[model samples]
Target: MNIGLFFVPFFEVMRMLFAYTTEKQLVNARNATTGTQYYCPDCGSLLIRKAGSLLIPHFAHSAKEICHGMSEGETIEHLNLKQMFYQWGQQTDQQWQLETPLNDLAQRPDLLNRKLAVEIQCSSLKSTRLAERIKGYSQNGYQDWWLLGVKLRPNKKFTSLQKQFCSFSKDKGVHVWGIKKDEISLFYHIYQQDQHYQYSKKIWPSYSVPITTILNTNLSELPPKIILSKQSVLAEKRRLAKRLSCSEPKVMKVQTYLYLQRRHLLYLSEWIYFPSRYSFFYQEDLLIFRLLFQQEAKNADTIFKKFLYYRETMQRKWIFHRIEEREILERLYLEAIFCQRKAKIL
Candidate 1:
């Protein structure tokens, strides 16, 4: 009855898990002269070996030994990237550890330095899994970077699913990373005031080339975009106008929404659409609301008890993120003021 060890291993898609021993040590273990036990780097539990094909030798957990929900299937892509990262890390001046265990975090980062954890993903990762990893790393006071082994085909941009893999946090913004044919490629700053700036980098991650060199870029050309700056609003309005004016019926919804709301079409303040970031990481349509405020009121906090629910109702479509209601209400009030100004100018 070769049922192949009864229970199924739970952990799938992991980079490190192996009984790494030299030929001498293997001989000693076979001879029973040296008591040897292969172990999981993360959990420090005993691992049994099916040791054959040197090309893919691995250690599996012994019978009924709980993996504590951290069993992983190390793919070829994971192996290759781990090796490359190993090579890169060996060259750096900082002391580095591979498959290093963080006692408090219960995380075994693929590569760990004094300050950071470099995690590699060659498979699809869920949002919950990603968030958990980030939270774990952060709580233990380590900066976490997730690198993927997937790359877009040349001339092809990232699909939404791929972009979602790069979760958003306040300071980091929207970013994704990958290793493409031996080169470290990065896509960051994926959100912007108008269309996303979409900066990218290609690197070899050498000793002379710290990762920072690859991470930072010159984004001076993109307009300085405060969320509600009048200029940025005007720019986005121009962008939206082209779509509204287009002959295509499918793209005329913005125009219809404007007419349905019975708002002025020519002025930017009259428009209050869904915050673009929730849809496709577009900059918020916030400038008109600012411009509408009296130069003084622009900086003051005013309670817009009247338009709060209306603005909330209008913009509440397909939003899956947090809505700062107070801010939205204030902006809605300013948008009304701007509309009145446009009418007065007319």
Candidate 2:
């Protein structure tokens, strides 16, 4: 027997079997409910049980309800927009209010910062109404409003109207105004149905920002922040010595370590490392690592161990000496990898 093929089917069968077991467990858990029967935790709606061969208990409302009817695929897109707004607010030293009411129009943006109103429009709306709603933001005191339209097969006319809206906002006093389209299909296909906003993050320039600015940031200023930590700098130098077949480290301490200790050194490193990982091959693995380490590290040690396994791979020989070094160096390498990955993925 071909072992590889057998293992392939074995894994597939195991996956399906696990899924089946899980679904059975869920059904049993749901049927044995201690309390309410029809309510969904997601949107606080009365759910009607959906029958299917899948065995998992699926529920739907009699009528479509906002947020309640969102497919499993869309949940992450919504969560990602929420998370991005949150991260942007933190980095920019701004506050993001969720579900905050706007002017008397009762329009509540998904996220509202001091200068910008961000709406995560996952559903289609009339083009005229959409334009009017955004124009209303300009009419109000919001100087920079962004409508992130998450749609499946966005209408060309809608895209054109969005461009017109940006132009119109420029004519007005608004400093920044734009519509970002996050294609649901792209998210589905590219991310392999993973629930985070990887697709949106990858194609963000298409919808959120300009491509040139993204490239410039990647090329000019996204490196040093990612790969060369204080310990990793020394490790890298040591690695170079072995590669050059010399006793002395090719890159001096002044070149590698002196600047590495500076308070703003990571920012410089970002500029150096960002360009290399822009290729397609490194992009996915890099992104997966970043998603794993986000918000888990307050200091260098915590960040490094997160993706230490990848460091062990011989493929990264171009970067470091033996992967098994001091814990501190290992940690630094992981952090650098994360930074490089995040810049590309985000």
**CA RMSD, predictions in order:** 8.4, 22.4
What local distance difference test score does each model get?
0.50, 0.36
| lDDT over C-alpha atoms for residue 195 of model 2 | 14
Q: What would the per-residue lDDT of candidate 1 be over residues 113-230, giving only the tens digit for each residue?
A: 7777887776665556655677787767887776777643212355544654564433334556677436776554454434544443444544446654454533333322334344
TM-score of 2: 0.29
Name model 1 segments beyond 4 Å from true.
1-35, 42-45, 48-57, 61-73, 151-161, 164-174, 189-198, 205-346
**How does candidate 1 fare on TM-score?**
0.56
Assess candidate 1 and give its lDDT.
0.50
What digit string (tens of lDDT, one per residue) describes model 2 on residues 17-121? Answer: 000121222222235343435443334444455334533333444433444123222233454455445444555354755444555544545566664766554
Error of 2 at 19 (Å): 32
Using TM-score as the measure, which candidate wins?
Answer: 1
